[model samples]
Target: MLGLLQRCLVRQGQRSLHSGRPALMAVSSDSGVGTTQNLSESDIHQDIDKRVKKSKVVVFMKGTKEQPQCGFSNAVVQIFRMHGVDDFDTVNVLQNEGIRQGIKTYSKWPTIPQVFLDGEFIGGCDIMIQMHRSGELGETLRKAGIESQISDPPAAKDTTEETTPSTSSTNVKS
Candidate 1:
């Protein structure tokens, strides 16, 4: 009975995973929501790989950095801005049907605003948020040679001299 219940639960989870909400690109009417023919997987992978390798920071997003079409993408743009990162390159996935869908498969990440650092797939908005909040994002950028304008100051050194142990002992009243 327990095994049967587990199987049913797994089926429900899979159904939800397959039935995720579609990404709204807010593209021009002419584009008509993925009307462009899809490209071969190998071609798409090659293109994305080249783009990632070519740029120090590459973001596969729904729109350009100047004009992000989705809120999630916009949040990512803002995060980069906060870190004073402006040299990054962004692919407007909304412009092409092949890449729009192919990118998700390429990254195995089911979301837009995918961040790639030094040809490495970092993650999506949530992961970036966590990294920024934990101060790791700035460090990562510095290592990549992108100096952050709002970088954290170096940790302060301890300067106070150690105090000697108390020489006198207090007596307790009976």
Candidate 2:
């Protein structure tokens, strides 16, 4: 009887991992009977969908926005900032198991730091930085109607200042 309860608990935990909802198994003290909670698989699927579509630019990385766990993720964020992008979202893949696996399958890229721009997969850090350096990133932003300003030096301004004529006196005579 005790062995059966242990098995049931393990099964419930596994279900929760995939279902995204804790499987409630009610075990009566005297009766030693258990009841399982029923959760639809669609419920989990829909939640993942909503999370993925919530942001314009979503980066699924190893860590949080404040601290990126991986070097690749750090580099990607830095490049985005250098491109003058202040608005974007990040998903710490380390936090969610489903998202971590689902994103790799969704993007068809087996990498931790995956970047998505405007709901489209934008590849990894190397590809993004390459595009950014080649000026294609700005073009892509324009295509998305994001209106990102490329770094351009401010034009020099002309300042008119009064100049006094210089007079030089010869050694002998002026």
lDDT of each: 0.74, 0.62
Write down the RMSD of all candidates, one decimal each.
11.6, 18.9
TM-score per candidate, chains pooled: 0.67, 0.58
Off by over 4 Å in 2: 1-48, 151-174
lDDT of 1: 0.74
Model 1: per-residue Cα lDDT over 1-174, one tens digit each? 224434543654454456564444354432232433465778777778888898899898876778666666776777888788988888878787687788899899998889999999999988987777767888889898889776664565665544656667889698
For candidate 1, report its TM-score: 0.67
The window of 10 residues in a row where model 1 has the poorest summed lDDT is 27-36
lDDT of 1 at 21: 41
Residue 27 in candidate 1 has what lDDT?
A: 47
